[model samples]
Target: MRADRLVSLVLLLRRHGRMTADRLARELEVSTSTVLRDIEALSTAGVPVYAERGRHGGYALLPGFRTELTGLNHDETLALLSAGPGRGERAFGLGPALASALRKVVDALPDAHLATASDASRRLLVEPETDLLSRWPVTEDVPATTMAEVRSAVLTGRRLRLLYAATGETARWRTVDPVGVVTVRDRAYLLALRSGADRTYRMSRVLAAESLPDPAERPDEVDLDRLWRDRCARFLADGHLTVLVRVDPTRRDDLLNTAVAVRTEQPGPDGWPRLELTYQDAWHAEWALWQLGPHAEALSPPSLRTALHTRATTLANRYG
Candidate 1:
């Protein structure tokens, strides 16, 4: 733990150029005395760190000094480089920080693996800017001042006063306890509680927000992953169609990935997998099955099979 702290301390100085002992302590979540001891440890371990004394002075790394940290294996190097194109940066308000961090990740790789990794990463696209049928990602205008308040309230366990619009409702001011922020498919949601009931508000829907001075009346800890999953299940259950089908095993992953909700799956006697799924509508079920080509077959709720048949007939006639 101390070794990690020492390394982190060095990196902090490296990234920021210099930091005062108190600032380092706050960042590292340690005592100022502990920070001083870590600096001594780093210096003793042959790191080129030094302190300057003055009202405007702090600790800094020597010129051109850097800790050697090229430990990524070939696959790991490529994996690290496989990042999406700045959608997260826009959603989380990270802006240019993601770009800067990615640059550092690539530059930190060993010399021999660097070229190979960079070359391989180029051939892979996480989310390309455009394709033949490109839908440009629209940037949502989540006001910086409002987001700042929401983030602070969530992080500090404080309540927030929000001028929010619920589906078709007018924007109204109400105090709510902050839970956490969730980003799904580039859209941000603020998960919080109002009147002790869980509520989810889209960031785009929040007209304005302010951090309340009072501490939020909520649990000390929340299982956000579990909570999000439960919410998603409940959401899909509302006005969503359920379809049972049989899919080839090889295409199982593709089906699961593309489906709105994979309710259940089981091995079938015919060597395929039986899948129960939920989708927004009959049209959605039709489109998803179409993507799987002949690998998937709709088995129930005859309307879905009808939709597929109609689509296939349309395609056949078009080609005819």
Candidate 2:
């Protein structure tokens, strides 16, 4: 851990040119004393770090002394720098690592392209969690400890014990063979096998996790991309209930959030949006539409219409 902290300290000074002991301590989440000790360690280890004693003085590395990564060309470096900010590395608890890597990449670029690449990267802004419509993308909060356990199990081929809560379900304990983890739109999913059956658990819903010593049962080689696609296809092809509805323009995103998918959309006769939405089941359809109140109307599937009508009537009666 000290080694990592030392490298991070060096990278920090390299990136910012100078940082006070307090600033370094805050950045590294350690005390000022620890920062001083690390700085001494760096100096003892032949690092060219020096201190400037003054009101505005702090620790800084010697000029032009940096760790270089020379493999990337100008375009490649630009692409990485431009795309690094919005990659949602924090979702996987690798935010620090990503930041360190990007700093190294910048340090490695040729002097001719260094300024140009930094400027170019600043021009391209990507926010994966924010869409054009300004709707905040749904995200899950996963604890660092749980993520570390899951990641360890997946990487080490160990069995993972999970306390997971599925959608609309109670939390349950299960031991699984972790295949891999994937991040989509700021949400993380852990693909694993439970009792020889495929299981995909959202990282946010994982209440607790542990990496067991027992080895996992899995293939010698895995194609996670193909597995994810196949599972998604199978899920979509399952017995999902479809509903036709007309929703107010303002509440469209509210409906979209609950619906499994939007099958079709068009302008309604009343100038509202008519959408064919899919749900997991009849109850799911009723609940999702009910959340929108009068802003959404179920147009087809007599059973669903009757269900909604009955519920609305009951509510009216209660308040009448």
Least accurate 10 contiguous residues by lDDT in model 2: 66-75
In model 1, the worst 10-residue window by lDDT is 130-139
Candidate 1 collision pairs: none
Q: For residues 6-35, what per-residue lDDT tens digits would candidate 1 score against the true structure?
A: 767888988999899999999999999999
Q: What TM-score should be assigned to candidate 1?
A: 0.58
Question: Global lDDT of each model?
Answer: 0.84, 0.88
- Among these predictions, the greatest TM-score belongs to 2
Every model: Cα RMSD to truth = 9.9, 16.2
**Per-residue alpha-carbon lDDT of candidate 2 for residues 1-320, written as tens digits (9 for 90 to 100):** 78778888998999998899999999999999999999999999889999998998999999999664265666778888877777656757777788998888777777878888888888888775667778776667788889989988999999999998888999999999999998876789999998899988889999999999999997769999999988876786699898999999998988988988787899988988999888999999999989999899999899999999999999999999
- Once model 2 is optimally superposed onto the true structure by TM-score, how far is the C-alpha of residue 257 displaced, in angstroms? 2.9
Listed per model in order, the count of residue pairs whose N, CA or C atoms clash below 3 Å is 0, 0
lDDT of 2 at 76: 77
